[model samples]
Every structure is written in structure tokens, then in C-alpha cells.
Target chain A: SQTIHQWPATLVQPVGSPLSLECTVEGTSNPNLYWYRQAAGRGLQLLFYSVGIGQISSEVPQNLSASRPQDRQFILSSKKLLLSDSGFYLCAWSRGNTNTEAFFGQGTRLTVV
Target chain B: AQTVTQSQPEMSVQEAETVTLSCTYDTSESDYYLFWYKQPPSRQMILVIRQEAYKQQNATENRFSVNFQKAAKSFSLKISDSQLGDAAMYFCALGETSGSRLTFGEGTQLTVNP
Candidate 1:
């Protein structure tokens, strides 16, 4: 069984503060990882995805960036946060290149103050 | 680029009744997959059902099923004998067979009434 862990279930950060959200997967190797953000009452939008370590593909231009430091460790970071950056962020992983089903974490609810 | 559309922003159904949520998608790929995910108040996304583009037969899983019309590029989810637990946000997603990326719809908030 594979599990994804996302930390700081709820975060309150001041504007211009640095931010880092981490996600990790267990029981799988070389899995595909993705980061998605959902605004209040809005659908989720894909922010970044990584197929392997040190490789990331961003779907949108925004105030955030993602990195895959380890095989199963992914981090979302921002140098300076903005009020508009607050939202619910989710981390997901798919088994392999051919697996269509993705498993998601509990998600992080960040509130920028 | 692939896009998914869920026309209904909200829907309601009586308990034990049947409700269908509509979904349509635009994609240039010939091989792909469609999925319906349920997100309850807890907000944990769970995969309800999935359909492959090359499959002709509709996919069903217990009370949840999908009507996949590949030619029309439409996929709808039908929930039979709806229960209170069914009340949640349902999302339609499109996945390419060659890639692991998924495109999600706007989502439909389903409210099951007793």
C-alpha cells in the first residue's frame, strides 16, 4: 500500500513570507507526482508535475515553484507569498507511467495574512 | 490541450433515487481515459469510476456507473439509489493514455435530500 503525506494541514503565513510545503510518497518507486491548487468554491488547477527527480513541468505561471529533491520527496516553495496565493493545495501520485488513477493527500489549507 | 467541462454547477436528488451528472471533454488524442472522482465534506478525493476510450461497453462499479460515448466525446455519471453519503462535489477528469497528467472539470456539487 502506498501513502502520501502532506504537512501543515492548515497554515497562516504573512504576506512576503517564504513558504514551503512538502509531500512524500511511500511504497512506490519512480511514481509521478503532481501539485494542484483549489481556490475557495473553485475547481482545482494543476500547478506542477514531476516524472522523476530533478525534473518538473509547470502548467501555469504563478508565484510558486516545485522541486523534487528525492525520488519520493516533492516540495512546493515560494520566495515571497502574496494574498492571492492562499488556497487549498493537494499532492497526488500515480503508480507508474501507464497508471491513470491517482492517489491524493489530505491537502494543505494555506491562508495568507 | 485537453479540457473537461461539467455543465452543472449543482444538482440535487432524493434519497434512493437516481441522478446523472453530465460531462464533456475536448482532446485530440485517440487513446485516453475518463474518470469520475468524489470529494465529500472531508475533501479527500476518491475515484468512483473510470472508462477507457477504446472500450465500447460502459463501466460500472456497484452503485456508480459511467456512460461513455466516445464518438460524442461525452461521459456522464449515474448514481443509483443515492444516499445521504453521496452528497458531495463530483469531478470529471480526463487522462491521456500516453501521459500521467489529468485535466479536471469545474465540478458539480451534488446534494442528496432525505
Candidate 2:
């Protein structure tokens, strides 16, 4: 069975501060990793997705960036945060095949003050 | 381009009753999959039910089932004997077999009344 782990379930960060949210999947290899953000009372928006290590695709332009350092390790980062950046961030992984059913992790609630 | 539409922004149902959530999708591909994911307050997406485009029979899982209309481009989720735990955000998604990418709808907030 594969499991996804996301850190800092909740965060209160000041404006202009840096942000780092990590997500890792165990028991899966070469999986497709994805980053999604959901605003208050809104659906999850696809932010970034990576098919392989060192490859990332941005769906919407914003202050954040995603990186896949290892095969199963994905990180969402921002150098300087904006107030609008506050939202629920989600990490998901798929088997990277034709029939893709993504499994999600417990999202990170980020509040920028 | 594939698009999913969950027109009802919110819906409510009484406990022990039936509730049907509507979903419509547009896709050019013939082979595909549709799914219903439940997101509770915890924010993790739980797969409620899934339907394959080619299947004529609806998919069911205990209290949950799907009415998959391939010709109509519709896949609706029906929850029977609803419970309080069923209150959550329901997202309808379409998966294209060629790309394996899922396109999600805006979601419907289902409130189960006790």
C-alpha cells in the first residue's frame, strides 16, 4: 500500500516570509506528483504537476513553485509569500499510468498574516 | 479539452433519505473514467464511487452508486440512506485515458441533515 505524508498540517506565516511544504510517497515508484490549492469555499485548483524527477508543470501562474527532488519526494515552495497565497494546499500522487486515480494527502492550511 | 460541470454549488439531504448529485462532462475521447471524490473537513479526498465510460451497468458500493450515461455525458452520484458523516464537498472528475489527467468540477457541497 502507498501512503502520502504532508507536514505542518497548519501554518501561520507572516507576509514576505518563505514557505516550504513537503510531500512524500512511500511504497510507490516514479509516481506522478501534483500540487493543488483550494481557497475558502472553493474547489481544488491544480497548481503544479510533475511526471518525473526534476520536471514540473505549472498550471496557473502565481508566487509558488514545485520541485521533485527525488522520485517520490515533492516540495512546494515560495521565496516570498503574498496575502493571497493563503489557502489549503494539497499534495497528490498517481500511479503514472493510463488509468490515473490520484490519492490525496491531508492538506496544509496556510494562513499568511 | 475536457471539462466537468457540477452545477449545484450546494445540496442538502435528510438523514436516511436519498440524495442525487448531478455531474456532466465533455470529452472527445471514447475511453475514459469518471469519479466522485468526497472531501470532508479533514480536506483529504476520499473516493466515493467510480464509473467507466464503456460500462452499461451502474457502479455501486454499498450505500453509494453512480448513474453513468455515456451518451448524455453525465455521471451522477446517488447516496442512499444518507448519514451525517456524508456531509462533505463532492467533486466530479473526468479522466482521459490517453493523458491520464483528471479534470475536476467546481464541486458541490452536500449537507446531510440529521
lDDT tens per residue, model 1, A1-113: 88999997999999999999999999999999999999876678999999999999999999999999999999999999999999999999987778578889999999999
| Candidate 2 clash pair list | none
Residue-wise C-alpha lDDT for candidate 1, range B1-114, written one tens digit per residue: 999999999999999999999999999999998999999988888999999898999999999999998989999999999999999999999999777799999999999999
Candidate 2 residues B25-75, lDDT tens each?
Answer: 999999998999999988889988888887899999999999898999989
Tell me the TM-score of each prediction against the true structure: 0.98, 0.96
Which 10 consecutive residues of model 2 chain A have the lowest summed lDDT? Answer: A93-102
Candidate 1 TM-score restricted to chain A: 0.97
Docking class of 2: medium
Q: DockQ for each candidate?
A: 0.72, 0.64
Best candidate per DockQ, number?
1
TM-score values for chain B across all models? 0.98, 0.98
Pairs of colliding residues, candidate 1: none
CA displacement after TM-score superposition, residue B103 of candidate 2 (Å): 1.6
Candidate 1 local Cα displacement, residue A9, angstroms: 0.6
Model 1 spans > 4 angstroms off: none
Computed on alpha carbons, the lDDT of every model, listed in order, comes to 0.94, 0.92
